[model samples]
Structures are given as C-alpha cells and as structure tokens.
Target: MLESVLKTIYVIWYRELIRFFREKSQWAGMIMQPTLYLTFVGTGIASAMTFRQAPGGTPVDYMTFIYPGIIGMSVLFTSMFSGISIIWDREFGFLKEILVAPVPRWAISVGKALGIGTIVSFQGTILLILSPFAGLSLTLWTALKVLPICALVGFAIGLLGISIAGRMESMQGFQLISNFLTMPMFFLSGAMFPLHSAPQWLQVLMVIDPLTYGVDALRNAIYAGIPEAQAILQHSIAYDLSIVGLFSIVTAATGVTAFNRQG
Candidate 1:
C-alpha cells in the first residue's frame, strides 16, 4: 500500500512537470514579472529613497533590501497560480480519470503541491542569479541556504492554491479568487517595504500574512553574513521557519481534506 501511494505521487508529479516544460510560455510568464519588478520598479524606488536594513546600522541600497522581497513575490505568484492546473485538469476530464484511480486522494493533493512547489522554487532560484545586479552580495553559501527556504515557501503557498482550487469549479472563479488573495498577500507581506516602520494596523495585517514570514525568512538567509543581519531581520531564522512550516502543515491538511471531499 505504501509503495502504491509513493508511485501514485511520483506519477502525478512527473505529469505536472512534463506539462509545465511543454508549455514554453509558462517559463517566460513566470520569470517575466519578477524580472520586470526587480529592474524597473526596484530601480525607480532606489532612485527616490535610500534604505538601510536597520536604523543607523548600515546604509543598504534599496535594491538590496528589496531583492529577497522580489524572490518571495515570484514564489508566491508562481505557486498560487499553479493551482489553476487543477481547474484545467477538471475542465478537460483528466482530473476525473485520476480520481477514479485506485490511489489515496491525499497523495494526489500532495503530489500536485510538490510538483508545482518545485516549479516555484526554480523560478525563485532564477531570481537569485540577478542578486548581484540588485546590489546584493551573493555567495554560493547564501544561494544554497536560500534554496530550501524558497522550496518551503513554495510548498506552503502551493498547498494553499491547491486547497482553494479543490473547491473551485471553474478556471474563471479560481483566477478571480487567487488574484484577490495574491495581491493582498504580496503587498502586506513586507515584500515591497519594511514592516518595522509600517502603521500599526498594517503591521497587524502583515503579522497575519503567511508570506510575511516567508519573505522575512528569505531576507534573513540571504543577508545572514552581513553585520547588520540581526538588526535587519524581523525574526530569527528559527521563528520564521517555524511559522512557514506550521502554515505548510495546516495547508497540507486543508488541501487533503478538500481533495478527499471532491466528487
């Protein structure tokens, strides 16, 4: 039984990967938004204001400060949108075929999440290649540490998308609901700005956003070697990971439950 479950997951994961690679447009679309934001938006903001990771610690460039945020933004968008694949499967009757297979429903959900999460992590890594251009001092060690965090962020958000897609009947509805959730999550996640100086009400919202912890964690990992690391980090790496892990667990359970209930 265990072997069967593992095989089922691998099959689903492989299928998703194949589908993603076959659609070359997915590559362009996934990478374009983050690239544009990092270059144009990041440049514009950097010109207007100087940013420091911490008050009087070190004068960090605006581009450096926002680099991790751009990575988080990429992972969040890619992972969340990847859930629409479920709707597409359903529309084409592929999902029905999978449902009828003699495999655990939870495995299906997990497999889909993992498949898309891998894609999201890949997208995030692509952004890491641009770190130097963003004024960040990238090291091999830093990139390695950042990779796992990206995978965790991707898995958590991918599960969220899966949970929502499981309950959605149409691609239109899924896209609408996803856009509504993604925009707010990105803006409030401290992705574009520092949360330390945010208004009280905004801080509360940021605290509740799972992506906030993800971004903070990425920032902590990416800047771990900097002298101002402690001052710049919103929370310790352990705390940030704990929050993201908890979120992943909750969303995994939720996604499995949704898949189990699907008819």
Candidate 2:
C-alpha cells in the first residue's frame, strides 16, 4: 500500500516538475513578484520604518528582521493559489484528461499538489539563494531543517487551490474565492506586520489564519541569531510542520474526494 502510494506520488511529482519548467511564463511569474517585492517594495518601505526587536528580544534592522516574513509571503502567495492553471485546463479540456486518468483519485490530487508545491518552493529557494545580499543568513543545518516545513505548507496551499478550482464552475467564482479567502488570509497573517502589535480581535483572527503560523514559524527558521537554547526554535519547528502537514492532508483529501465524486 505504502509503496503504491510512493510510486504514485513520484510519478505525479515528476510530471508536475517537468510541466513547471516547460512553461516560460510560469517560471517567470513565480519568481517575478518575490524579486520585485524583496528588492523594491519591501526595501523601499523598510527605508522608512524604524528597526525594532522581534517577538524575541533580539535587536536587528527592520529589513533583516522582516525578510523571512516576506519569504513566507512569497511562498504562501505563490504556492496556494497556483491551481489557477486548473482554470485554463478547464477551458481547454486538459483538466478532463487528468480527471479521466486511471490512477486512484487521491493520487491524481496528490500529484497536482506536489507538482505545484515543489514548483512554488523553488521560487522560495531562489529567494533564499539571494537572501544574504538582502541581509538574511542561517546555518547549514538550520536552512535544511526548515525546508520540509515550507514544502508542507506549499503542498497544502496547492491542494486547497486545486480543490477550489475543481469545485468552482466559473472564473468569477474563483475570483470571489481569491478575494474573500486568499487576500484576507494574507492580510491577517504576520507577513507584513506583527500580530502582537495589532488589536485583540486581529490577534484572535490571526490564530485561525494558517499563514500567520506559517510566517511566524518560517521567520523563526530563516532569519538567524536565534538563541541556541531557545524554545522558539522548537515551537516554530513543531507548529510549522504540524500545521502544514495537517493542512496538506485535509486539503488533499478534500480535493480528491470532491473531484472523484464528480466522476
């Protein structure tokens, strides 16, 4: 059972990877916003905001302190709604081919999730590659350690996107989904601001927003100078992995069930 699942996942993952690179616009689109956001919007804004201590007591410049949140931002935005391609597939009939595949239903959804997740993670990796010049740094062990967490979140986002795309009947509906769910989720997350600094209700809202957990956990990982003995590292590691993993399973299962039900 496990082996079949693994093989199915592998096939889907490889196919997704190939399709991801073959499209020029997709690659360009994935990296474009992160590059511009980090280089222009983020830096441009940070030039005005004063540096302050993070949730931890560590003192640092604003850009450095906030860069991981931006990385999480890039990943969350790029990865989650990536199922927009399903919209095109719906129009042109490619989605039918996928839907009619002989493979198990979950395998199909899992494949799509992994494909989009991996593709989006690459964009985050590119940001990581350029991070040092942008004033971020971390140990080899720490960097490698944080990746699975990020990938899990990416996978969940992609799966949820697919589930939404599979369920919706129109682009207008998807646009409403984007506006109602995606944008609000991003705003509520600490991607651009600290949750503690917000009013009590906003803080309460942030708890339900998975992106907030994602950003806080990633911020703990990618940005350096963590105290060696601190539980923040442990808590961050635990929450990020747990939340992403939960999201992936739930969304993947939901997407698979919803699509296969239509069959």
lDDT of 2 by residue, 153-249 (tens): 7888878887888787788787688667778788887777776567999989987888777776777676546452132232455766687677677
Candidate 1 local lDDT, 70-165, one digit each (tens): 999999999999999998988898989999999989999888888987787778778888888987778888888888888888888898899999
Off by over 4 Å in 1: none
Clashing pairs in 1: none
Off by over 4 Å in 2: 1-8, 53-58, 224-234
Using TM-score, give the best candidate's number: 1
lDDT of each: 0.88, 0.71
Tell me each candidate's TM-score. Answer: 0.96, 0.87
Worst 10 residues of 2 by lDDT: 226-235
Number of clashes recorded per candidate = 0, 0
Q: Give the CA lDDT, 0 to 100, for residue 3 in model 2.
A: 76
